[model samples]
Every structure is written in structure tokens, then in C-alpha cells.
Target chain A: MTSSKDTEHPLFQRIEGVRQRTGRVRDPIVTQAHGGGGKAMRDLIDDVICGALGMSAQQIQEDQARFSLAALAQYGDRLAFTTDAYVVSPLFFPGGDIGKLAVNGTINDLAVSGAIPLYLSCSLIIEEGLPMETLRAVLQSMGEAARAASVHFVTGDTKVVPRGAADQLFVTTTGIGVIPQGLEIAAHQLQPNDAILINGYLGDHGAAILVARGELQLETTIESDCAALHGLIAALHDAGITIRAMRDITRGGLSAVLNELAQASQVHIAVDGTKLPIRPEVQGFCEILGFDPIHLANEGKLALAVPSEQIEQALKVMHAHPLGQQAAHIATCRPTPAGLVTLDTGFGGERILEMLVGEQLPRIC
Target chain B: MRFVSEFRDPATGKKVLQQIEQQLRQLGHDASHPLKIMEVCGGHTHTIFKFGLEGMLPPSIELVHGPGCPVCVLPVGRLDDAIAIASQPDVIFTTFGDTLRVPGSQKSLLQCKAEGADIRTVYSPTDALSLARQHPQKKVVFFGIGFETTAPATALTLLQAREEAVSNFSVFCNHITIIPTLEAILADPSLRIDGFLGPGHVTMVIGLEPYTFVCDVHKKPFVISGFEPLDVLQSLVMLLEQFRQGRCFVENQYKRLVQPQGNRVAQQAMQTVFEAREHFEWRGLGSIPHSGLRLREAFSAFDAEKHFAIPAQQVADPKACQCGDVLKGAIKPWQCKVFGTACTPETPIGACMVSSEGACAAYYNYGRLSTSRKLEATR
Candidate 1:
């Protein structure tokens, strides 16, 4: 017993050290010193992502002692897996950051999959020689988000690289959660008579990111709705309604996601632009931006599909939840010719929602 | 919404369409004397495409997209200037995202960004102020690009920058006034354009007086139209009526939004901040006198030109590209040798193909898709 335990302790420390060094040197913007694999890599991790995030000593430890399977035992069966990368130009923004975005994004991926998020595996690739205090702040924010979502960080991998190989810092989080018993949801499972519903307005996240990065010049204040949606999903499931399909409106916003679903299910999605609740400030912003709100990204929102008959029930339950209070029935399922997301314009014309050909704006494209 | 929605009523739009149709029939469908009319603004082009106005118009009333969309017309040399400024160690370049994809002397702003340049896309002029305040040590140059509609905001920003005395902030002004460009197109004998669809916002600022050139010198009809879908249709109807009556004058279809004299305070601010450059380069039409603005000498400190020594360089247009003919309304987009072949939207070789407001882009987005149905229709 003494021989095995003692051998494993040092082995764990060595593995942890390797993981830390790797995260620093493999950063998108790498530097010569990061490749040196000496003090530079440690400094990179300590300064950029980990330092700003301010993780506890336990979290910083490079071992599996901090994790437990019981933490994710809430949902007994089917597991949901999702991962996302955060590469916003500006490291910080109004109302949130990469840390918060990483946490919320992982949780939403599971939530919209009809799963109760259980645990997350965080991976960070940070640039070399960034400030220590900035890294600490980011870590603290990530820890707060994890705690708020009631999810545990069970495992993680870190990599670092030389300067100029990456942006300031990028965090990739892969989440695994368990789907509740008896819950069956699939994109192709959507029936022709299914109704389309949205939690709230679109384009807030994309617009906020634009404003935060100082890319757009407009006379409006907009903020990203970067939030975890586990609470809202729980409320919806408890309302005793069967869901056909669900998805979070992310990168391509509502339109891209809707187009994907419509193509998958071989049915039509007709969105009512007028009924879709849009913030006046966001709308005013879109007018000058030449950006449609529907094609913008929404972080703290979800679109759900349910039978037309169950729409009233689903809407009532969504209304009861704070996150879903602004939820609206945006469209109905129509027998469209196999595949298309048609938008019924305010002027009584129908426009096809074409798949995004290129990045909406090329700076990020 | 209040000022924009009322003009798009279907019932009224139908009436205007009917009136134009009747007038066009009276003019007779003569190919040699086609009633060619050019909507001389990018905003109009966008409206024309969005509403499928070309398909709705009479056969004789040929609607040509004019030299509008400043982003589309911004030459590669100026883009290179912006790229040079953006690549500077202590300079942050702010521009619209549309400008980033535009090629500049073998490089684009997006490509520069990929090379670690501090290029940011902004939606409004004020956003540059924040970047300036945040990066005090770095020079923040707002690559000001747009037509007169956007000039007021850019002017206000320069005014604000001067008042604040933000040493690190400057504007690389590319704002081209619309009047001379219109004049250049109208004076050209080859165009033979019957009437002009005047710009609404430019009219809002400089007022209807500036467009008197069409009536006085060019002797062509000018109808100032709002940007809405129905407003464009109404303007066409008005132009056709003027043609039927053998009248050459300026009419206003966007009376609610535009006035004879625009916002005086805004114009006064622009006058204080900027002055007309003796001559400015247009992408397709070459150099036009008094078409562009430079910051007044008094506001030189806030002008990027005062700090940087980048020389303005003239670049030759790509050979066989017919952007000049297109801008002059002498040829349609389809007539260009590279219109949809070597110069498709994915690989745009000219400004007209790049900008969303560009005539080529409008044609590609709205009309090109249905080309097979109208293969033999367009001249």
C-alpha cells in the first residue's frame, strides 16, 4: 500500500506539470519562449487564463482527486456531449467575458439537448507572458459560473505556446450531462404540425460583441445575453410537456439554427418577424449595422419545438420562468416543399432563409 | 418606422405603378430611343433590388444602377492607405466590416487582421471615440467611408474629437460628396439617361437646390425618392409622368423625410469640420472636382493626414473591366466581360462587385438567381 500510494502522488504532480506547460505553449499566438518549455510556459498559464480566473488550489492541482461520478448522477442514463470555443476579439465585454461564455455555452449545449448538465471539462490555450492579475480575474469568473450552474469541473487540459500564435486567450469547454429518463428529443423527430417557439429576441449577443470590441459605431447600448439556461429547461420539463426538439441560438443566431432544423426535419418553419420580440435599441442598431437581428447570435436563449396543440401549455410554462418570460410563439409548422425556413415579411412577402454563405462579418470569418 | 412605412402602401404603390405603365406605353417601345433612367444612389439600388422593381417596370423604362455605394467605389489605393495605417505598431484602424473584405493593392483589411493588425469594424462614428480613449498611447484612425447620408455623423465625430482634443484620435476621411459624381454622370453625352432618381438623405442635407444641375445644365428630370420599396416605385411613376408631359424638372417623392433645406445645424457642423478637396478620385469615373472632403486646416490635429505621410496614389483600373461604362450607365452589369464569369461575387475584382450596395452585388443577390428565366430579356 505504501509503495503504490507514494508512487502515484509524484506521478500525478508530473502529469499536472506537463498539462500546464502544454496549455501555455500551444496558444493560438505562440512565442519563442513558450516553446522553451521552461518558466515561460508556467508564467503564460499563471498570467493569462488561470491567473485571471483565480482557481482554488484544488482546481489548480493536476490530478483526478477533485472529481467524482456522484456529482453528475442526477440523470441516470443517456449522456449528452457538447463543446464550444470562445475567440471574441476583445477579451472583456459588457456584462460578460470568455470565462462566463465558456461556462454558459457548455451548460446550454446540454440544456437544449434535453439533458441536465452534470460536469464540464475545461481546456484553455493561453498566450505567453500575459498579465497575472488578468488571468486571475478570468478564472474567478469561470469558477463563479460553474458554481451558479451547479456543474462541477471534473477534468481539464491546458496548453500554451509562444507569443503571436494565438489571440490573447481562448477557452474551449466540453460538457457531458445525462438526459432525464423518458426524454426523447431529436432534430429529425420534429413532426409536421409542430410549432416553433423562441425564448426571446435575437442578435443581442452578436451586437454586444460588436459594441464591446469597438467594431461598430452606433448610438445605442446593447448587451450580450450570455447566461446558462438549465433553470429554464428544468421549468419547461416540469410543466409536463413533451418536447420534439430543442436548440440554442448561437453563432448563426436564430435563422441559421432554424434553417438547420428545417433541413433536417424536411418541414417548413415560418417565422413571424412582427411577433418576434426585438429590443428597440437592438432594432435601431440593426438599421445602421445592415445586420438582421434574426441572423445574429443569442447566448441566453433557446428555441423549442412542440406539437401545435401543446403550444399554449408550453408558452404558459415558459412565461412562469424568469428566463422564459419573454418567450414567444414565433412561427408555426407548415407543409413546405420538403426543406426551407420561410420568413413572412411585415410587407406580406415570403423570403427564403438562405444558409449563411460566409461569416456575417469577415473580421471573425 | 413612422416616416418610412407610410410610403410603402400597396394600394398607393399600385396607383403609381399604373400611372408609370400608361406613360411608358405612350412613349412607345422604341429600342433606339429607350427611356433610360438611372437611380443615382446605392440606397436606391438596394431598394430597387429588394422590391424587384426592374421586373415591375415597363419595357421602355430601363432602370440602370448608377455610381453609388462609396464602399464599392473606394479605390484600392485608399484601401492600401487604410491598411498601411492599420499595420502601424501604435495605430488602431476602425472601419465598417464591409470595408475589411475590400481588396487593397494586393491585400485586404481582413488579411491584415490575420497578420495581427489592430483592425476593428464599427457601426457608428462614436465607437471610434471609445477606442481612442481606451488606447491613448496608440493612434486610433477612423477610416471614414460613406456618402453624404453618413457624412453628418462622421462630421459630428470630428467635431467632438476636436473639442475633446484627443491627441491620439484622427479620421482618415474617405467621405465623397454625391453632387459632383451626379454631375459627372449627367454631363457625359454617352449616358443618354432621361431622368435622375435623386438621393433622399443628400437632399435632406444640401437640399433640393444642389440637384438643379439636372434641370438647368443637363436638362434631365430629377426626382428625389425615399429609400423604401414603394417610394422607389412612386419615383419611377413620377419620372415617367414627367417624360410623358415633356418636362425636365426636379420632383420630390419623399417630402415627409426630405425638405428643400436640410438640418441647418448638421450642415453648419460639417462646414466647420471639413472642406471640399480640389479633386477626389472615384473608382470607375476617375477624379472628379470637389467630390471629396478633407478636414479643415484648423482641425488638422484630428486629421490622420496631418500625422501620417502616406502619399495618395492613383491606380489603374483592371483592363477589360467595364466598371466605368456601368457607372456612366452606358452598359448594364451583364454586359461586362467579367460580370459573372471571372468576376463572380465570390472573387470580386472591382468595387461594384464587392459592396452589398454595389450595383453588381444587387444584381448578383436579387436578379442573378433568376437569370435563366430572363436570359434573353436583358439588353
Candidate 2:
């Protein structure tokens, strides 16, 4: 039996070597031939995907990775799954690119749910004539982000369309995570008197992307706050703090997230404008463009609702982490006047923070 | 943020609030009949709501949002004319972002854009000129809309286009003078505004001499104010002091920015490029003589009205909308029947409900909840 097993292993090893030797792509630009179902496609995949992601020979050969039943049972029966598509114009920005955004975005979605992100499936749609260097840079960014977050990309697919049929490139990431037992966190779980905390300043990502677009023609030093947050979340749990709900402040920003929580939990959220963390530069950018910072987008920052009793411990844990060095207590949930978010202005007035109707556009006058 | 932070200091704001209260007390004003001060600039209205200045004021003082939002006062007929020009196949229509959402009789620029119209939002007319330069094959028309503050920028851009010989670039000039609009407001008997908080930016262009009419003819106090929380509060104090002393005169509280003679070069550029229209119909207030500006005969080649054949037909305001009353400070925004029910930022029924600086949009988005809470607390 030992002799038979050794012979089978050598046979598999020999097949992988032959495949690797033959499947080496040389073209510097993506073309229709790279996506066609032939040797060219295999060569492109082996050179671009496996080389950049550093996939093992055995892992690259499998259609999908399989896990043992015993390993899956340790994290409980619930699995968290989420998918997101990244299509930022300009493809690259001050601090991150589309590939990094795809990885961090999906991981954040799962992380905010109190789950441990484990695996991700990447899919790329490449336009013909895209330079290989750009692809390599993007793939390298994705690989580094995945490694930093400690998640594995076990499977992926690639398709090449005609030039102008798509943008230079687009990436979609689907992530799966495991939720531990006895842990429940959801938007609807927010209770009255819960403390609302933010991990850091808002609008950095939005301001950075806006400047990177080159429309404003103004210089800025702001960088996108795109990052994974599962490690900071784990630290919070380790601190023995009970987290009721958490949400990453993205597209519509802090105002949107607060409104969502208010509507889901049927409570009122009163945010103090002075207490909300905002960088001076971001504030200046919004001032010139006539935008409200609360409505601006964020990437790495998150809003958390913890029981009043555990807020102190949660804040301590958050402030100790690198990502949460600027953590702040922004607001508090109230039992009365359900489904509303109000801001106590720094200038001493109260106003309702509503979800914006459409995109916030710069005012000329 | 240096110049900005000092004007927004909460301590200074409180001190100004106390002075306003003291002046009101000297004038024997109370909540029963609050002293209504109309700030005739959308920028001031925006600052008031953004900083919660209204709530910080004494109940004896009331702020009346005025018809200073250029987007809010654009007649629907003019918007339709703009849309008609924008829908042409070879035309690339450009406008400020806030103006894109203002509804015409048939459709808004946003809706037209979604249906494949080439409407782009530009920060300034210069940006539109750049687009024109890039797309020489397409006819570029800029919807130039603003008061005197923005008119100078549009004028300068047009002058540059002429110098560069960019034949494809033209402007649909809807620039209105503030003096005429303010005069129209004062002439109205329904509006009980005791004093006026003049627009700082506009006065920086037109100068203080033009606003002296408010004091000379109407015997009403007018204070040129800056667009900051402290500026607004301090301006209110100035206006109240005038009321307390029974004086009606023009004061310059924004002296740091606005010169007595205004910006000479900007004024010169405007004169070189534009001439007053015979009459221009305001959205809420009816036609005022020589209120709007049009390209001069020398610059007719760059006039959108003359370049394109547009249907310049008159369309009446929605009957359900009381924006005229709102603009004239005759009624508060919430007092309008369809404020939150039908006219909202999402589905705006009036121009005032569309722009961010519009009184209705500001009240709807920021003031409604707070006002209700204040009522609840009082109860």
C-alpha cells in the first residue's frame, strides 16, 4: 500500500510539472486569444493568476477547495457570504486601487457581521489591449491585501471581452466567513441607550477619490482609508465587550449608516457634530465643494453600537489598535422618536440627518 | 480653515446672540410678534441651517429666508428652454450641478441626461469652455446662472472664449442683478420684513452704493453680512440695534471682504460682455424690468438664445406651490401646504425644493425634525 501511494504522488507531481512548463504565456497585452478555450487561455491563467497569487500546484489544479467536516464544525454551523463589485474610475487612487478595494470591501462586509473571513473567490473581466503591467500591479495589490487579511483565494475565473466592451478591468470578489456560536450582531439588534462609536475620521476615501479624478484641479494630501477590519474586531471581542451591531461607513457615509440602523432598529440616533471625528483637510475639501462631510463616503472606518455598559471597554480596545487610533463616540440611540437620525450641530442647533436624494454635486454659486 | 474657524467660534457666536437678545429687549420685541429679518442671500440661509443659528437665537428674533437662490428663482419656462437646447443631437449642454435637478415643465436636466442627453455638470464656465475646446465637433452651450457674484466669472470665461476664437462655445446667460430683486421684495406690501441682511458675496461685486436704495427709498435698515455663523449672528445684532435706535441706514459688517467700490476688473469684464435685458421673468415674482443680463450685440455670436432656435414659451408655476410667498418671506417653508407631503428634495414640485440653498430643501432636510422636537419640548 505504501509503494502504491508513493507511485500515485509522483505521477501527480509529474503532471503538474508538465502543465507548468507548457502553460507559459508571453504576450504583454490581453487579447481575445487569452480568453478562448484553448492552450492560450491556460497559459494566460498560469502566468497571470497562479504566478501573481502564488497558488500551490495542487490548489491551482482543483476546481474548488474542499474543507473537512470536522474543521467546519469548529466555527459553528452559520456561514457568512457576501459579494461585491469594484468599478472605480481611473482604476487607481492615492492609497489603493480597484483590486485592493474589491478585497477589502468584501472582507469588511463579512467582518462587520462578527464573522471570521476565511475564503474569497476572485473574478476578473479584462478588456482586450490592457497592458500586462497594469494587470500585474493590480493582482499584486490583491495578493498583498489578501495576505494581510489572512484570507485564501481558493478559486477564481477570468473573461476577456473586446476593447471598449468593458473598462480596462473590473474585479468582483465573493467572500465566505464563519460566525462563531452564541454571537449575534445585526442592524436590528441595536437597542436604546446603545453607544455609537466610529473607528476613525470620515470622508478620507471620498476626498481622495475626488481629487484623483482630476476634475477639481485642486491639490490634496488625503489618502483613501481602504483596509480590512477583522483584526480590530477580534481585538474588541477579546476585550470582553458585547457588540450589538456594526457597519462599515461606505457609499452614503455615516449619515446613511445611521439612518439604516435607526430604521432597522426602530430607534432615534442623536449624533453630536463636535464629537464626530473629521480631519481638517477633509473638512476643508468639503467646504470648498459645498459637500457635507457626514454624507461623504468612507472605506476602512466603521460605526459600532455597543451596550452603554460595555462602551468604555470597547473604546479602549479600539483605541489600542492601529486602525482605530482615532476612534470616537459619535452618538447615542434613544427609545423615543423612532426611525430618525439627528445631529446636534457644533454651532448649537439640531437638525435631521437625512439620506441624500441623489448624488451630492458641487454647487457653483 | 484659518479665516473660517474664527468666524464659527461658539463663544463668539454666544456673545453675538446675547447682543442680539439685548437689542431685541431694548426694542421691546417678544415671541408674540418676532422681529423678522430677511437675509436676501441663499448663502446666508445655508449658513443659518448648517450651523443651527436659528435655534440659538432668541425667540424674539426670526429669520426669513429670501429669494436669493438663483437656482430657486429660475423660471420654469427658462428651464424648458434650456432643456430644449440640451436635447439637440449635436449639442453638449453644460451647467452647474445644482441646476441640473431643477424641474422644467416637462423634464429635468437629470432626467434628460438619463435618457442619453449629453448634459454635464461643471464647476465654472471655464470648465465648460474646456469641454468645448475638447469637443470642437459638438456645439457646447453653458447654462450661465447666478447673481452678480457668479456673473463676473461667466463674463470672464466668455471673454476668454472670444479671445481664443472658440466658435463652438456660447452661453445661455440667466444672470440676474440683486438690486432689482431686492427692490421688488420691498415693494411687496405682504412681506413684513423689518430689515435686510444683504448678500456679502453679491455686494462684493455690485458694491454698497446699489443697496443704499433700501435705506434711501424704503427707509429700511440693510447690513452687508458675511456667510458665516458669526457673521450672520453679528449682522442680526447690527440690524436689531438699528431697530432699537429707530435708525434706517446701510451698514457694512463684511468690510473685510467687500470694498465700497466693489471689484473693478470684474465689473469691467461684465460690462464688456453683457447688457441688461428689457425684462426678465422671475420664477415667483413676475417680470422685473432690466433684471437679467444678456450678451451684448457685439458678442451676439456667443449668445445661445441667438445661436439656437429654442422655444422661449412661458410656463406658469405649479398652482399647488406657494414658493412665491415663501421667497417673499410671507410664509415659512413648512407652512406651505405641500411642503413635505408633495414637494420634497426627492420629488421636488418647485424650484425651491430642488437646490441645496433653496429654503424648502434646507427646511425639509435639516429643520423639519428639529422644529418638531422644539415644539414637543415646549409642550
Candidate 3:
């Protein structure tokens, strides 16, 4: 249990004072009565959801969250909205869980758009048999993560389904943020000779998830690289380096992200294979299972295209951040032969990458 | 990763390239038609294309991707049998993840799985065996498919099943051998391959003695290489030096793991539980005699083929698909009539387009770089 620094904000502290008189769900496990809109549901919501998030601020009694237009306007000129769902198997994994992923993943969706993520709305669909302890732990994690990232879980919903209806728990988080004035990062802005930079090691989350499934019977120390990225992006913006375009490497991994960027920007990207910062254990896992690290998922890692002259400054800012300690300049963007991505193997050959067609099945041959 | 990383040195690879180029110059070979070499293992083909090894080498050298991928060569009829068996009630069909998407005559195992069949992908045969132990009332069948390197695992698993008296555990053994298939390829008069990068894992199982015929009878150079980049380059140097001196024989460059006699314990396990079938049908090539293996009479009780009746129909490859030519080095994958057109990986009309290790799939995935017509293939 870690303390959340952002919870010390005066606005949330006021809610904390009011929340001290709330009710509790005495049941050890969730049941149908929790979804019946009765006293049971109110206690579950008040004690579990609002209690863990640190600030519900009257949103539980209301249908929608209220925000100050001027306060939001002060942060930026435009509003960035994004949504994602997490139905990951086993809900809990090393370094993070569905709760942490729900917070960080949605925050990243806004941050990568050059926005300062301000608030998130969470909805949880918990299966009937889920232990009350599990829900509390997950909600607690969501609160800690959001609080630590200086974002608020201003509104939320919780529903309990029949045991067979869901796989333990499902979390969906929607985030909105503000894009500061004069910040115009986009894929189409990517130009020839632009350098591609990454925050840290690639594919840890994907490898960690695959190994956590216990299908391959492999032993590894790899953990999911799940963390909030809005702060890291803020550091980059503070340095005043032009970020041509930025994308968090999540599902379909970096190759898929680069392919989309290349197509959108109409530029060819040449990735130096040696420059990729993949951990040896992750690489070995991919080797044994016949998976490509470039096509594997990451939660905290991001790829950004920046101007050639701004490369060193951008990297210096990234290196100073706690999350971007292993930041690397990996590839160079060039006018193509558009919509093509290639990896220079460092063995004197260039291997072209296509979007991974489907699930990266392990090869036996 | 110790032994593995040591063999991927780019510096050593460059030095080997110099010697190989020098040796080729001395041998008087040029890029007019090119000196063709066949690496007769899908694992080797994967390495060659993955590292862009074929493109990095001298332009005069061409690597003929052989019919070594078991998933690629699995006949449509056998796949149909597997699907029919898997679709049965109270039966759990297990296979390597690589074989899940391979197209059968009608549908693939993955499609069948999607249609509510219990087809599970396992990393090893033992995992399937565990499933059988866990579900005693249900039939658990491991779809055992590979060449010599993979057959031993299936063999050992079957032996363990017998030892444990696990009645529900069985193997759909689609295991194949290397020598007879090589013999069949060599017998083809149309192929004019100059040398061979021998299948390292297969050679490690059958041992080097079995490949002496390729030198004595066929008079073609053979070099068994490791899967790593540097080992491949070093093996090419060995093969080229032999070609420079007009020598033809089997040489082992993967001495770290591959021995002259191979793993005796694994060979012993294989000999105990299995015997070669008289003839086995290949997808590209027709029937090759004594090429595939099946459970021995003593272990027939643990054989899935014996346990369940299947639609053992001989389904033909599509009329336009020329996978045979690609496997035999007669033409490049792109040269096929339906290659990147009617026979793409998404809707593969040929068996070769099914597996990543297959030359067609590898080419379609890794080699299709250009937006329009492909670059002249270095493979």
C-alpha cells in the first residue's frame, strides 16, 4: 500500500472529509443483491468505488460529472477524449493489474496526443462470484494510480453480473485531457530524416502477460511495464522540443504503431535493430517462443518522431524522467516508397516488417 | 543465451563472407545463373530469411527453401483427418501453435476450434499428456508433427504414457524423416542444386552417416550448419571451400550440439516406440517411400489414428497452386500463378502459404517489402 501524493490536493481532501461518514459492504463476496439498486448497491458503490478512489465528490448521487470550463481552459485550448476496455485474463499480473492498466492505459491514450490528462471515468463489470476483497484491492489500486498521476476518478459505475457472464472482472476507463496552445503533434507532421525515439525497454508487458498465462511453462523475471505516462510527456513538453508525433506502444506492439504512423505520414521508417532496448530475458522469451519483440505489447513504452536537430535535447529531457531512464533514439524517418517499415538487422541486411496478421503463434519448426 | 548469442557475431560473419567470396572467385562461379544451395530445413529457412542472410550473401548464391516445414508439407488429407478427429465429442485435440492455422482440405484446426471443437495448442507433447491425465474420461490426442528433431519428443511422451498406463493419452503421429525425402529430391532430374546446407537438427538425430550417399551417389557437397548467423556463414565457408576443391561429402559445422552419432538416448526412445511408414504423401511432392513414421505395433494402443476413425480422404492441392515447384527450387514463390494474388496468406490455396516456416508464407510476410511488384528475391 503506497501513499498517493496527488490525494493531498485541497479539492480532493474536502471530499475525503465528507467520505469518512460513508457506508460499507459487509459481504465477503459480491452477489445479486449488490446489483438490485437497493441499500446493498449503495453501500457497495459508496464503500468500494468512492471509498477507494478518494474522490467521488457527489458524482455517486448524480448521473454525470460536472467540470469547470474555465479551469479546464486554463490548461489547454482543445479537449482530448479517449476510451479503452481491459478484459485481460487473470486480472492481476506482475508490476500492475487490471486496475493499474485501466488507469495508465487510458491516461496514455490522452498523453500521447500531447494532452495533460486531467480526469477519468471508470466502469467496472464484476462477475458475481468475485470476492469483495478482490474488488477492494483493484479499486484501491485504481485510486492510488490515478492519484499518483495527478488525475481524478471523478465518476464511476459498478455492475455485478452472473458468475458465468464475465471472467472475474472487466474495467473500462475513459479519460479527457487538455491540449496546450501551439502544440500541434500529428503523424502527418512527421518528415524525412526525423528521428524516432522510445521511452524505455520494449515488450515487457506482452512477455509478462504471455508467461503469466502459464501456457508455455517458461520461467522469467519480466514484469509488465505499466505506468502513467502523462508526467513523462509533460517533461518532454517542458523542454520545448518539437514532438512530431507520439504513440504509446500497446496492442499490436511498436511495429503496428509504426506501420500506422508510416501510412499516415507517408514516410518510410528505418529502425536500427541494435538500437532497440529489449531486455535479454524478454528477447530470450521471444526467441524460444518464436515471437518478435517489435510486435509485442508494452504499457509504459512510447515511440515518438522528432526533428533531427532536436534529437539530443529531447533525449536528455526523457533520460531525466524516472520512467524514460533507458530512452533511446531507435529509427530514422525518411520519405519513401511510402507506407513501408524495415528493420536494419545490424548484420548487413534489412528485414521488412508487415503488420502482424493475427495472433503471434509460437513456431514449432 | 550464452551459446546462442556467441554465434550471432557480425564481425565473424563479415570475415566468413570475405573468405566465401574469395573461394567463390577461385571456383569461377558467377551470377549468370547463380550457384544454387538448398537449406533443407524450415528452421534454417526461417533463420536465412529472418536475418536477411540470403540478401547479405554474394549475389551468385541462391538458397532453395526445401520442403522441411512439417506444417507446410502436412497433406490436406491428414489435416482433414485431424479436423474430423478433433470435432468428435469427448476428445481433446492438442497441437503445436504453429500448426493451428494450417489449412486443411475444408477447414483448419483453428476454424474447427472456433466452431466449438476442443483443439488446444500445446508447446510440447507432455502438455497434451498432462491434459489426458487431468481429463481421464475424455480422449486427449497430441497431433505429433515434425521431422527427426521433433519425433523423439512424441516418442518419449508415448513411452511415458505406456509407463504410466495412461489409456486416454495418444498421439496422432505425423512425424517424418529427412533422408528419404532428400533422396527423393536428389532423384529429381530437373533440380540442378550445386550443394546442400544439411538440416542440422535432423542430422543430429539420424547422424552424419546417412547423408554420405548425397556425396558418393549424387556427388553434391553437404555441410550441416547451426541455426545462428555466424554458424551459417562459417558453414557456407566450409561448403564453398569444399566446392572450390571439387569435394563432395557431409561436414558438420554445428559441432557444439550436433555429434557424428547424434543423441543416442533420443534415438533409442524413437526406435522403441515408432517405425517408418512405407510411403507418406507430401503436399508439394507426391509420395516419398519410407519418409514418415507411425506408432509401432507394441504402442498401437496409444495411437490416435487407431483410436478414432477419420475421413482419410486424398484431397488435392488447388490446380493453380505450384507449391511443389517452390519447394523443389524449380521457381521462386512469387513466380507461382496464384502466389501473391489468389493464394495470399489470409486465404492460402496452397499448403506452403500456411506456415511461417514455409517458403511461401515467409516470402509473403518478410520478403514482400515493396508496395507494388516485389523486389527480385534474394532467396
Shift in Å, residue B142, candidate 2: 1.6
Residue range B1-379, candidate 2, lDDT tens digits: 7878898888877777888888888888887778988999999989988887777787787889999999999999999999999999899999999988899998999999999899998888999999999999999999999999899999999999999999999999999999888888888999898899999999899888998889989988999999889888888888888877788998999999999999999999999999999899998887988899999998998999998989999899999999999999889898999999999998999878988899999999888775775567657
Report the poorest 10 consecutive residues by lDDT, candidate 3 chain B.
B370-379
Q: What residue pairs are clashing in model 3?
A: none
Off by over 4 Å in 2: A1-22, A56-65, B373-379
DockQ (Cα-based) per candidate?
0.14, 0.69, 0.48
Give lDDT: candidate 3, residue B365.
Answer: 78
Per-residue CA lDDT of candidate 3, range A167-203, in tens? 9999999999999998998977789999999999999
Residue by residue across A1-365, what tens digits does model 1's lDDT show? Answer: 46666747977779767765534434434455653656765555554545444444456557552535565465656778899888776777776888899999989999988898877877877777655455556777898898888887766656655677778788899888898878987788677878988888778888888777654434357878999998988888888888888999998878888888888898888777567878877776666556678878888988889998889999999888877888999977777655677665544334455555456753110
All candidates in order of lDDT, best leading: 2, 3, 1
Quote the positional error of residue B129 for candidate 3 in Å: 1.0
Candidates in order, interface RMSD in Å: 5.7, 1.2, 2.0
Give per-candidate clash totals: 44, 0, 0
- Cα-lDDT of candidate 1: 0.77
Task: Write the residue-wise lDDT of candidate 2 on A124-169 in tens digits.
Answer: 9999999988888899899999999989888888899998889999
Residue B103 lDDT, candidate 3, scale 0-100: 88
lDDT of each: 0.77, 0.89, 0.89
In CAPRI terms, where does candidate 1 land? incorrect
**What local lDDT does model 3 show for residue B224?**
96
List the candidate 3 regions with Cα displacement exceeding 4 Å: A1-23, B369-379
Name the candidate that leads on TM-score: 2
